[model samples]
Target: MRIGILGSGNVAKSLSRGFVARGDEVRLGTRTGSKAQLAAWIAEQHLAIAQGTLEGVTGWAEAIVLAMRGMANPETVRAAGEPAFRGKVVIDATNPLVWRADGFPSLGLPEPESAGARLQKDLPGAKVVKAFNTIGHAHMVRPQFANPPTMFICGDDPTAKTWVTELLRDFGWSSIVDVGGIERSRLLESLCVLWITCGMRLENWNIAMRLEQRI
Candidate 1:
């Protein structure tokens, strides 16, 4: 699979590496100034190509990963052109988080529902699924947990959800839990707060969430 990731930040780069490791091609998209960094990463990792513009990548990839800043998703859509994402499974790994006056992060989704819902609204032609938002970038793929962590995924399109599940499996996840439709994205997004707060308070960022059950 050819994956195009919008944003050269940590999340995007981390996912790109994971995809490439799983033998899927990757094209990292970024602004002109970020291309050098992207190029360095590509060379260092010896992965696939990198594009300087959003349109460049959107056209090249079979699937898209919207790993950009949550508030900037609309801009990414406009830059990539709405028509390019039609019928493609877009993995949304964003959270609409903003620091509040109390020095804690909070959801700032303009759509007031969830980031997945908001992205679906922004790219009506695209199939958007919420995932990879509950964990840190370093632990995105093949996490070093005591046990396999649970990945909570949700999307309106069942087919899209299945597709993302396959991809996540390839990335070394074996415990993926489908929590429900896109509306449930709110819960996943909010989970980030707990993950972050616990990490900060405990002074540990290497921990992860695992769903345990009795046989």
Candidate 2:
């Protein structure tokens, strides 16, 4: 599958390399048209990946990953445009985090209360699935723990969730849980905050969560 990741940050770089390593075509999108870091990444992974504006990537790939910072908000989504994302499965890996004066991060949304919810409202034609928010980018792919960590995903469209679950599986997530609809994004994004706080307190980014099931 051809995937377009709309960010220049660590998440975009991580997922881009992971997908390409698994033999999928990848394009990374950022507001800037620069390709310096992306070029280095391509060489490091020993694979080719295209880099372009978010608008360019949206049209070039079969799937899109919303890997940008949540602070960009409506303008960022607007910049990418609706036509580019129409009828596509968008894996939303963003959180609505804003640093407070006290040096703690907090959710920035007011009501419908999640970055994923806002994305769905703005991009009605896109199938938005929320995943990969509760873990660090470093651990997103091929993570090794005593037990495999679970990835929580939610989207309005069941088919879209299934498709994203399969992609998550391919990315080395053995436990992908579909936790209902896009509304669940509020909780999922908060879970990211929890993960961040735990990491800060424990002084370790390697800690991860794995749901234990009695099946």
The lDDT leader among the candidates is 2
The residue pairs in collision within model 1 are: none
Candidate 1 Cα outliers beyond 4 Å, as residue runs = 110-112
Of the candidates shown, which would achieve the greatest TM-score relative to the real structure? 2
**Residues 1-215, model 2: lDDT tens digits:** 88999998899988887888888998888888567887787778776887888788888889999988886757778888888889999999999898888776778887657899889989999999999999999999888888899999899999999888887888889988888989999989988988988888888999787788998
For candidate 1, the TM-score is 0.94
**lDDT (10s digit) by residue, model 1, range 111-184:** 44888887888888888899999999999998878799999999889999999999889888999999988878
Give the clash count for each candidate. Answer: 0, 0
For candidate 2, give the lDDT of residue 157.
97
